[model samples]
Target: MVNGDDNNARITNGNLAEVGQFPYQAGLNVSFGNSSTTWCGGTLISHRWIVTAAHCLDGAESVHVYLGATNISDVTEPGQRHFIVDQSGIIVHANWTKSTVTNDISLIKLPRLIAYSQTIRAAILPRLVNGSYSLYEQQTAYASGWGRDSDSSDSVSPVLRYVAMPVMPHILCRMYWSGAVSEKMICMSTSSGKSTCHGDSGGPLVYRDGNSSYLIGTTSFGTSMGCEVGFPAVFTRITSYLEWIREHIPDLP
Candidate 1:
Protein backbone atom coordinates (compact mmCIF):
# COMPACT_ATOMS: atom_id res chain seq x y z
CA MET A 1 0.00 0.00 0.00
CA VAL A 2 1.72 3.19 -1.22
CA ASN A 3 -0.63 5.82 -2.48
CA GLY A 4 -1.10 9.48 -1.74
CA ASP A 5 -1.05 12.08 -4.38
CA ASP A 6 -0.80 15.79 -5.16
CA ASN A 7 2.73 14.70 -5.93
CA ASN A 8 3.10 13.46 -2.38
CA ALA A 9 2.57 16.82 -0.77
CA ARG A 10 2.10 17.38 2.95
CA ILE A 11 5.33 18.56 4.58
CA THR A 12 4.49 21.77 6.26
CA ASN A 13 5.45 21.90 9.88
CA GLY A 14 7.36 25.10 9.56
CA ASN A 15 8.06 24.71 5.86
CA LEU A 16 11.80 24.18 5.87
CA ALA A 17 12.83 27.76 6.37
CA GLU A 18 16.39 27.21 5.22
CA VAL A 19 16.77 24.14 7.35
CA GLY A 20 17.39 25.55 10.78
CA GLN A 21 14.74 25.10 13.45
CA PHE A 22 15.24 21.56 14.63
CA PRO A 23 12.79 19.98 17.02
CA TYR A 24 13.35 16.26 16.97
CA GLN A 25 12.50 14.31 13.83
CA ALA A 26 13.64 10.80 13.11
CA GLY A 27 11.42 8.18 11.40
CA LEU A 28 10.14 4.66 10.77
CA ASN A 29 6.62 3.23 10.61
CA VAL A 30 7.07 0.00 8.64
CA SER A 31 4.42 -2.59 9.06
CA PHE A 32 3.71 -6.09 7.84
CA GLY A 33 0.75 -7.50 9.70
CA ASN A 34 -2.37 -6.47 7.86
CA SER A 35 -1.17 -7.20 4.33
CA SER A 36 1.90 -5.55 2.83
CA THR A 37 2.98 -1.93 3.38
CA THR A 38 5.89 0.56 3.44
CA TRP A 39 7.51 3.69 5.01
CA CYS A 40 10.94 2.94 6.47
CA GLY A 41 13.16 5.93 6.20
CA GLY A 42 15.40 6.28 9.22
CA THR A 43 18.37 8.02 10.81
CA LEU A 44 19.35 8.56 14.42
CA ILE A 45 22.80 7.28 13.86
CA SER A 46 23.32 6.30 17.45
CA HIS A 47 21.50 6.07 20.76
CA ARG A 48 21.24 2.55 19.58
CA TRP A 49 22.01 3.01 15.92
CA ILE A 50 19.57 3.18 12.99
CA VAL A 51 20.12 3.87 9.33
CA THR A 52 17.75 2.37 6.86
CA ALA A 53 16.78 0.92 3.47
CA ALA A 54 17.79 -2.72 2.90
CA HIS A 55 14.60 -2.84 0.91
CA CYS A 56 12.57 -1.70 3.90
CA LEU A 57 13.23 -4.83 5.87
CA ASP A 58 12.64 -6.98 2.79
CA GLY A 59 9.92 -9.31 4.05
CA ALA A 60 8.93 -7.38 7.17
CA GLU A 61 7.58 -8.22 10.55
CA SER A 62 6.69 -6.30 13.69
CA VAL A 63 8.75 -3.20 12.79
CA HIS A 64 7.41 -0.01 14.33
CA VAL A 65 9.42 3.06 15.26
CA TYR A 66 7.95 6.56 15.43
CA LEU A 67 9.91 9.30 17.06
CA GLY A 68 8.88 12.83 17.99
CA ALA A 69 6.03 13.05 15.48
CA THR A 70 5.28 15.69 12.94
CA ASN A 71 2.00 13.83 13.23
CA ILE A 72 1.76 10.10 12.90
CA SER A 73 -1.46 10.01 14.81
CA ASP A 74 0.28 12.23 17.34
CA VAL A 75 2.24 9.11 18.29
CA THR A 76 0.18 7.90 21.22
CA GLU A 77 2.61 8.39 24.15
CA PRO A 78 5.35 6.68 26.21
CA GLY A 79 7.60 9.68 25.71
CA GLN A 80 7.72 9.10 21.97
CA ARG A 81 8.91 5.52 22.38
CA HIS A 82 11.07 3.19 20.27
CA PHE A 83 11.43 -0.44 19.25
CA ILE A 84 13.57 -2.49 16.81
CA VAL A 85 12.82 -6.15 16.91
CA ASP A 86 13.72 -7.13 13.37
CA GLN A 87 16.87 -8.84 14.63
CA SER A 88 19.48 -8.92 11.87
CA GLY A 89 17.83 -11.10 9.33
CA ILE A 90 18.09 -9.01 6.21
CA ILE A 91 21.50 -7.39 6.26
CA VAL A 92 21.79 -6.99 2.50
CA HIS A 93 24.47 -5.48 0.25
CA ALA A 94 27.06 -8.03 -0.67
CA ASN A 95 26.79 -6.17 -3.91
CA TRP A 96 23.04 -6.22 -3.63
CA THR A 97 20.85 -6.22 -6.70
CA LYS A 98 17.29 -7.39 -6.36
CA SER A 99 16.88 -5.98 -9.85
CA THR A 100 19.59 -3.37 -9.56
CA VAL A 101 19.92 -0.41 -7.21
CA THR A 102 23.17 -1.50 -5.66
CA ASN A 103 23.56 -2.39 -2.01
CA ASP A 104 20.39 -0.86 -0.60
CA ILE A 105 21.80 -0.63 2.94
CA SER A 106 20.25 -1.28 6.41
CA LEU A 107 20.91 -1.53 10.12
CA ILE A 108 18.51 -1.24 13.05
CA LYS A 109 19.75 -2.64 16.37
CA LEU A 110 17.65 -0.60 18.78
CA PRO A 111 16.04 -2.35 21.67
CA ARG A 112 16.64 0.67 23.87
CA LEU A 113 18.77 3.83 24.15
CA ILE A 114 17.06 6.57 22.16
CA ALA A 115 16.47 9.11 24.87
CA TYR A 116 18.35 12.12 23.54
CA SER A 117 15.73 14.82 23.55
CA GLN A 118 15.69 18.30 22.06
CA THR A 119 13.23 16.55 19.95
CA ILE A 120 15.49 13.52 20.12
CA ARG A 121 18.98 13.60 18.79
CA ALA A 122 21.74 11.73 16.96
CA ALA A 123 22.59 12.51 13.32
CA ILE A 124 26.06 13.56 12.35
CA LEU A 125 28.28 11.32 10.30
CA PRO A 126 30.45 12.49 7.43
CA ARG A 127 33.17 14.68 8.75
CA LEU A 128 35.16 14.23 5.59
CA VAL A 129 35.82 10.63 5.26
CA ASN A 130 37.17 11.50 1.89
CA GLY A 131 36.13 14.73 0.22
CA SER A 132 34.15 16.36 -2.56
CA TYR A 133 30.73 17.94 -2.07
CA SER A 134 30.44 20.86 -4.37
CA LEU A 135 27.71 21.10 -6.87
CA TYR A 136 27.91 24.78 -6.21
CA GLU A 137 27.45 23.85 -2.58
CA GLN A 138 24.70 26.04 -1.29
CA GLN A 139 23.89 23.06 0.90
CA THR A 140 20.48 22.54 2.45
CA ALA A 141 19.42 18.95 2.27
CA TYR A 142 16.87 17.26 4.49
CA ALA A 143 14.22 14.61 3.80
CA SER A 144 11.44 13.31 5.99
CA GLY A 145 8.84 10.64 5.51
CA TRP A 146 5.42 9.02 5.67
CA GLY A 147 6.06 8.10 2.04
CA ARG A 148 3.85 7.99 -1.01
CA ASP A 149 2.76 11.37 -2.08
CA SER A 150 2.19 9.82 -5.47
CA ASP A 151 2.68 6.75 -7.63
CA SER A 152 -0.97 5.85 -7.83
CA SER A 153 -2.01 4.76 -4.32
CA ASP A 154 -0.72 2.46 -1.63
CA SER A 155 -1.90 4.82 1.12
CA VAL A 156 0.57 5.84 3.87
CA SER A 157 0.96 9.30 5.29
CA PRO A 158 -0.68 10.63 8.36
CA VAL A 159 1.58 13.69 8.48
CA LEU A 160 5.37 14.04 8.48
CA ARG A 161 6.62 15.27 5.21
CA TYR A 162 9.70 17.27 4.46
CA VAL A 163 11.75 18.17 1.43
CA ALA A 164 14.54 20.63 0.81
CA MET A 165 16.58 18.97 -1.88
CA PRO A 166 19.42 20.70 -3.68
CA VAL A 167 22.70 18.93 -4.17
CA MET A 168 22.90 17.65 -7.66
CA PRO A 169 25.61 16.75 -10.10
CA HIS A 170 26.93 13.29 -9.96
CA ILE A 171 27.57 13.96 -13.59
CA LEU A 172 24.18 15.57 -13.59
CA CYS A 173 22.73 12.54 -11.87
CA ARG A 174 24.30 10.31 -14.48
CA MET A 175 22.54 12.38 -17.10
CA TYR A 176 19.16 11.55 -15.67
CA TRP A 177 19.95 8.09 -14.40
CA SER A 178 21.53 6.67 -17.50
CA GLY A 179 23.24 3.43 -16.44
CA ALA A 180 21.09 3.52 -13.33
CA VAL A 181 23.28 6.07 -11.59
CA SER A 182 25.74 4.76 -9.07
CA GLU A 183 29.16 5.63 -7.61
CA LYS A 184 27.28 4.77 -4.53
CA MET A 185 24.78 7.47 -5.53
CA ILE A 186 23.75 10.88 -4.14
CA CYS A 187 21.61 13.50 -5.80
CA MET A 188 18.66 15.67 -4.91
CA SER A 189 16.16 18.04 -6.49
CA THR A 190 13.05 20.13 -6.03
CA SER A 191 11.85 22.82 -8.33
CA SER A 192 9.74 23.75 -5.34
CA GLY A 193 7.43 20.79 -5.80
CA LYS A 194 9.26 18.93 -3.00
CA SER A 195 10.07 15.18 -3.17
CA THR A 196 11.06 11.80 -1.71
CA CYS A 197 8.08 9.80 -2.78
CA HIS A 198 6.95 6.18 -2.67
CA GLY A 199 6.88 5.62 1.05
CA ASP A 200 10.12 7.50 1.47
CA SER A 201 12.02 4.28 1.67
CA GLY A 202 14.61 4.14 4.44
CA GLY A 203 14.64 7.90 4.70
CA PRO A 204 17.16 10.41 5.95
CA LEU A 205 19.45 12.36 3.66
CA VAL A 206 20.38 15.27 5.89
CA TYR A 207 23.06 17.94 5.75
CA ARG A 208 23.48 21.20 7.64
CA ASP A 209 26.74 22.03 9.19
CA GLY A 210 27.26 24.94 11.51
CA ASN A 211 24.91 23.74 14.12
CA SER A 212 25.21 20.06 13.19
CA SER A 213 23.17 17.64 11.05
CA TYR A 214 24.85 15.21 8.74
CA LEU A 215 23.65 11.85 7.61
CA ILE A 216 24.73 11.60 3.97
CA GLY A 217 22.03 9.49 2.28
CA THR A 218 19.58 6.58 2.24
CA THR A 219 16.16 7.31 0.72
CA SER A 220 17.47 5.39 -2.33
CA PHE A 221 15.07 5.54 -5.29
CA GLY A 222 13.07 7.82 -7.50
CA THR A 223 11.54 8.66 -10.84
CA SER A 224 8.14 7.08 -10.59
CA MET A 225 7.08 9.92 -12.86
CA GLY A 226 6.92 13.17 -10.91
CA CYS A 227 8.30 15.13 -8.04
CA GLU A 228 8.17 17.70 -10.80
CA VAL A 229 10.20 18.06 -13.96
CA GLY A 230 12.44 15.32 -15.24
CA PHE A 231 12.69 13.33 -12.04
CA PRO A 232 15.69 13.49 -9.67
CA ALA A 233 15.84 12.18 -6.12
CA VAL A 234 18.22 9.38 -5.43
CA PHE A 235 20.44 8.57 -2.43
CA THR A 236 22.46 5.99 -0.50
CA ARG A 237 25.90 7.48 -0.61
CA ILE A 238 26.68 7.99 3.02
CA THR A 239 30.27 8.57 2.08
CA SER A 240 30.30 5.37 0.09
CA TYR A 241 29.28 3.46 3.12
CA LEU A 242 32.19 4.69 5.16
CA GLU A 243 34.17 1.53 5.65
CA TRP A 244 31.04 -0.54 5.36
CA ILE A 245 29.51 1.72 7.99
CA ARG A 246 32.35 1.17 10.40
CA GLU A 247 32.42 -2.52 9.73
CA HIS A 248 28.79 -3.17 10.46
CA ILE A 249 28.08 -0.66 13.17
CA PRO A 250 30.96 -1.10 15.56
CA ASP A 251 29.65 1.76 17.62
CA LEU A 252 29.63 4.35 14.84
CA PRO A 253 30.48 7.85 15.92
Candidate 2:
Protein backbone atom coordinates (compact mmCIF):
# COMPACT_ATOMS: atom_id res chain seq x y z
CA MET A 1 0.00 0.00 0.00
CA VAL A 2 1.19 3.51 -0.80
CA ASN A 3 1.18 5.67 2.32
CA GLY A 4 0.82 9.17 0.82
CA ASP A 5 -1.38 10.99 -1.71
CA ASP A 6 -2.43 9.40 -4.98
CA ASN A 7 -0.20 11.71 -7.02
CA ASN A 8 2.95 10.22 -5.48
CA ALA A 9 3.24 7.81 -8.44
CA ARG A 10 4.57 4.53 -7.04
CA ILE A 11 2.00 1.78 -6.67
CA THR A 12 1.79 -1.90 -5.78
CA ASN A 13 -0.63 -4.46 -4.30
CA GLY A 14 0.20 -3.67 -0.69
CA ASN A 15 -1.45 -1.30 1.87
CA LEU A 16 -0.49 0.71 4.95
CA ALA A 17 -2.23 2.10 8.07
CA GLU A 18 -1.01 5.25 9.77
CA VAL A 19 1.57 4.97 12.49
CA GLY A 20 0.31 4.93 16.09
CA GLN A 21 -3.15 4.18 14.67
CA PHE A 22 -2.26 0.51 15.05
CA PRO A 23 0.01 -0.70 17.84
CA TYR A 24 1.50 -3.43 15.64
CA GLN A 25 1.93 -1.16 12.59
CA ALA A 26 4.71 1.28 11.60
CA GLY A 27 5.33 3.36 8.44
CA LEU A 28 8.67 3.11 6.56
CA ASN A 29 9.44 5.78 3.98
CA VAL A 30 12.86 6.38 2.41
CA SER A 31 13.31 10.06 1.62
CA PHE A 32 16.29 11.58 -0.16
CA GLY A 33 16.15 15.35 0.35
CA ASN A 34 12.77 16.87 -0.66
CA SER A 35 11.46 13.89 -2.62
CA SER A 36 10.25 10.67 -1.00
CA THR A 37 11.45 7.78 -3.13
CA THR A 38 10.12 4.34 -2.20
CA TRP A 39 7.88 3.16 0.63
CA CYS A 40 8.59 -0.13 2.41
CA GLY A 41 7.05 -1.56 5.58
CA GLY A 42 8.79 -1.84 8.95
CA THR A 43 8.32 -2.69 12.63
CA LEU A 44 9.35 -0.38 15.46
CA ILE A 45 11.46 -2.68 17.64
CA SER A 46 12.78 -0.06 20.03
CA HIS A 47 12.55 3.66 20.78
CA ARG A 48 15.26 4.25 18.17
CA TRP A 49 15.63 1.06 16.17
CA ILE A 50 13.43 -0.35 13.39
CA VAL A 51 13.63 -3.85 11.92
CA THR A 52 13.03 -4.22 8.18
CA ALA A 53 14.19 -6.09 5.08
CA ALA A 54 17.77 -5.52 3.95
CA HIS A 55 16.72 -5.33 0.32
CA CYS A 56 14.77 -2.17 1.21
CA LEU A 57 18.01 -0.36 1.93
CA ASP A 58 19.90 -1.77 -1.08
CA GLY A 59 23.04 0.20 -0.16
CA ALA A 60 21.47 3.62 0.34
CA GLU A 61 22.63 6.25 2.80
CA SER A 62 21.21 9.45 4.34
CA VAL A 63 17.72 7.99 4.84
CA HIS A 64 15.07 9.61 7.07
CA VAL A 65 12.66 7.73 9.28
CA TYR A 66 9.11 8.85 10.04
CA LEU A 67 7.40 7.76 13.21
CA GLY A 68 3.98 8.49 14.78
CA ALA A 69 2.41 9.18 11.43
CA THR A 70 -0.98 7.87 10.28
CA ASN A 71 -0.72 9.22 6.72
CA ILE A 72 2.43 9.82 4.70
CA SER A 73 0.88 12.98 3.25
CA ASP A 74 0.39 14.37 6.76
CA VAL A 75 3.67 14.66 8.69
CA THR A 76 3.05 17.91 10.56
CA GLU A 77 2.24 16.34 13.89
CA PRO A 78 4.52 16.98 16.88
CA GLY A 79 5.71 13.43 17.32
CA GLN A 80 5.93 12.56 13.65
CA ARG A 81 9.24 14.22 12.91
CA HIS A 82 11.79 12.47 10.72
CA PHE A 83 15.11 11.34 12.20
CA ILE A 84 18.40 10.67 10.43
CA VAL A 85 19.99 7.27 10.83
CA ASP A 86 23.54 6.90 12.16
CA GLN A 87 25.15 5.60 9.00
CA SER A 88 28.30 4.36 10.68
CA GLY A 89 26.48 1.83 12.82
CA ILE A 90 23.96 0.62 10.28
CA ILE A 91 24.07 -3.15 9.80
CA VAL A 92 22.62 -5.38 7.10
CA HIS A 93 22.84 -9.12 7.36
CA ALA A 94 26.18 -10.26 5.92
CA ASN A 95 24.63 -13.08 3.92
CA TRP A 96 21.79 -11.07 2.38
CA THR A 97 21.07 -12.13 -1.19
CA LYS A 98 19.64 -9.91 -3.91
CA SER A 99 18.74 -12.75 -6.29
CA THR A 100 16.85 -14.74 -3.64
CA VAL A 101 15.33 -13.24 -0.51
CA THR A 102 17.39 -14.89 2.20
CA ASN A 103 18.75 -13.25 5.36
CA ASP A 104 16.86 -10.14 4.34
CA ILE A 105 16.98 -8.42 7.73
CA SER A 106 18.65 -5.07 8.50
CA LEU A 107 18.80 -2.56 11.37
CA ILE A 108 18.84 1.24 11.41
CA LYS A 109 20.31 3.15 14.32
CA LEU A 110 18.89 6.61 14.87
CA PRO A 111 21.36 9.42 15.59
CA ARG A 112 19.52 10.20 18.78
CA LEU A 113 17.48 7.98 21.00
CA ILE A 114 13.76 8.31 20.36
CA ALA A 115 11.70 9.15 23.37
CA TYR A 116 9.18 6.45 24.21
CA SER A 117 5.66 7.50 23.24
CA GLN A 118 2.32 5.99 22.39
CA THR A 119 2.98 6.40 18.69
CA ILE A 120 6.57 5.10 18.65
CA ARG A 121 8.28 2.23 20.44
CA ALA A 122 9.64 -1.25 19.94
CA ALA A 123 7.81 -4.55 19.41
CA ILE A 124 9.04 -7.65 21.17
CA LEU A 125 11.30 -10.06 19.28
CA PRO A 126 10.50 -13.74 19.58
CA ARG A 127 12.76 -15.71 21.88
CA LEU A 128 15.14 -18.10 20.14
CA VAL A 129 15.68 -20.14 23.26
CA ASN A 130 12.00 -20.92 23.56
CA GLY A 131 11.40 -24.66 23.54
CA SER A 132 9.51 -25.20 20.30
CA TYR A 133 7.41 -23.14 17.85
CA SER A 134 6.02 -26.10 15.92
CA LEU A 135 3.58 -27.22 18.61
CA TYR A 136 0.73 -24.98 17.43
CA GLU A 137 -1.48 -25.43 14.36
CA GLN A 138 -3.70 -22.36 14.43
CA GLN A 139 -0.90 -19.79 14.99
CA THR A 140 -2.17 -16.55 13.51
CA ALA A 141 0.03 -13.58 12.56
CA TYR A 142 -0.56 -9.98 11.39
CA ALA A 143 1.18 -8.07 8.55
CA SER A 144 0.85 -4.38 7.54
CA GLY A 145 2.17 -2.42 4.59
CA TRP A 146 1.54 0.19 1.85
CA GLY A 147 2.08 -2.04 -1.18
CA ARG A 148 -0.47 -3.10 -3.77
CA ASP A 149 -3.68 -4.82 -2.67
CA SER A 150 -3.42 -7.31 -5.56
CA ASP A 151 -0.99 -8.60 -8.18
CA SER A 152 -2.62 -6.84 -11.14
CA SER A 153 -2.32 -3.30 -9.66
CA ASP A 154 0.63 -0.97 -9.13
CA SER A 155 -1.32 1.72 -7.30
CA VAL A 156 -0.39 1.95 -3.65
CA SER A 157 -2.75 2.65 -0.75
CA PRO A 158 -3.18 5.98 1.01
CA VAL A 159 -3.85 4.21 4.32
CA LEU A 160 -2.14 1.16 5.76
CA ARG A 161 -3.94 -2.16 5.32
CA TYR A 162 -3.64 -5.29 7.40
CA VAL A 163 -4.35 -9.02 7.01
CA ALA A 164 -4.35 -11.95 9.39
CA MET A 165 -2.95 -15.29 8.22
CA PRO A 166 -1.99 -18.59 9.75
CA VAL A 167 1.59 -19.83 10.03
CA MET A 168 2.36 -22.57 7.53
CA PRO A 169 3.84 -25.78 8.76
CA HIS A 170 7.61 -25.83 8.16
CA ILE A 171 7.45 -29.25 6.59
CA LEU A 172 4.77 -28.19 4.13
CA CYS A 173 6.56 -24.93 3.35
CA ARG A 174 9.91 -26.66 2.84
CA MET A 175 8.29 -29.25 0.62
CA TYR A 176 6.79 -26.55 -1.60
CA TRP A 177 10.06 -24.60 -1.86
CA SER A 178 12.27 -27.71 -2.11
CA GLY A 179 13.66 -27.02 1.38
CA ALA A 180 14.60 -23.50 0.35
CA VAL A 181 12.67 -22.21 3.33
CA SER A 182 15.34 -22.31 6.02
CA GLU A 183 15.39 -22.09 9.79
CA LYS A 184 15.61 -18.32 9.44
CA MET A 185 12.36 -18.15 7.52
CA ILE A 186 8.72 -18.25 8.63
CA CYS A 187 5.90 -19.12 6.27
CA MET A 188 2.33 -17.83 6.46
CA SER A 189 -0.73 -17.73 4.23
CA THR A 190 -4.45 -18.39 3.97
CA SER A 191 -6.56 -20.60 1.69
CA SER A 192 -8.26 -17.47 0.36
CA GLY A 193 -6.90 -14.17 -0.97
CA LYS A 194 -5.52 -12.84 2.32
CA SER A 195 -1.78 -12.09 2.77
CA THR A 196 1.01 -9.52 2.29
CA CYS A 197 2.17 -8.42 -1.17
CA HIS A 198 5.08 -7.13 -3.30
CA GLY A 199 5.75 -3.85 -1.51
CA ASP A 200 5.15 -5.31 1.92
CA SER A 201 8.83 -6.31 2.16
CA GLY A 202 10.46 -5.53 5.49
CA GLY A 203 7.12 -5.25 7.28
CA PRO A 204 6.65 -7.19 10.47
CA LEU A 205 4.74 -10.44 10.81
CA VAL A 206 3.67 -10.33 14.43
CA TYR A 207 2.08 -12.96 16.65
CA ARG A 208 1.08 -13.11 20.31
CA ASP A 209 2.71 -15.64 22.60
CA GLY A 210 1.50 -15.42 26.17
CA ASN A 211 0.89 -11.69 26.92
CA SER A 212 3.21 -9.89 24.47
CA SER A 213 3.37 -9.28 20.76
CA TYR A 214 6.45 -10.97 19.26
CA LEU A 215 7.93 -10.14 15.89
CA ILE A 216 8.20 -13.56 14.35
CA GLY A 217 9.10 -12.53 10.85
CA THR A 218 9.77 -9.72 8.38
CA THR A 219 7.90 -9.79 5.04
CA SER A 220 10.17 -11.15 2.30
CA PHE A 221 8.70 -12.86 -0.77
CA GLY A 222 5.92 -15.01 -2.20
CA THR A 223 4.88 -16.56 -5.50
CA SER A 224 3.43 -14.66 -8.46
CA MET A 225 0.04 -16.07 -7.54
CA GLY A 226 0.03 -13.28 -4.88
CA CYS A 227 -1.91 -13.74 -1.70
CA GLU A 228 -4.28 -16.35 -3.12
CA VAL A 229 -3.87 -20.13 -3.62
CA GLY A 230 -2.56 -20.56 -0.11
CA PHE A 231 1.00 -19.99 -1.34
CA PRO A 232 3.27 -19.57 1.66
CA ALA A 233 4.53 -16.03 2.24
CA VAL A 234 8.15 -16.11 3.38
CA PHE A 235 9.59 -13.90 6.12
CA THR A 236 12.91 -13.53 7.93
CA ARG A 237 12.38 -15.17 11.25
CA ILE A 238 13.53 -12.70 13.93
CA THR A 239 14.15 -15.51 16.40
CA SER A 240 16.75 -17.08 14.09
CA TYR A 241 18.73 -13.86 13.94
CA LEU A 242 18.37 -12.70 17.53
CA GLU A 243 22.08 -13.01 18.24
CA TRP A 244 23.06 -10.93 15.23
CA ILE A 245 20.42 -8.34 16.06
CA ARG A 246 21.46 -8.06 19.69
CA GLU A 247 25.16 -7.90 18.85
CA HIS A 248 24.52 -4.69 16.95
CA ILE A 249 22.08 -3.26 19.49
CA PRO A 250 23.05 -4.60 22.88
CA ASP A 251 20.16 -2.96 24.68
CA LEU A 252 17.48 -4.86 22.74
CA PRO A 253 15.85 -7.79 24.55
lDDT of 1 by residue, 55-155 (tens): 77755674777665555666573346656566453355566564666777777767767667656677877775346543323467887776655444466
* Model 2, residue 234: C-alpha shift (Å): 0.5
Which lDDT values do the candidates have, in the order given?
A: 0.64, 0.67
Alpha-carbon runs more than 4 Å astray in model 1: 1-67, 81-119, 130-144, 154-156, 159-169, 172-174, 177-185, 188-195, 198-203, 206-214, 217-224, 227-253
**Candidate 2 Cα misplacement greater than 4 A, ranges:** 1-21, 31-36, 77-79, 128-137, 209-211
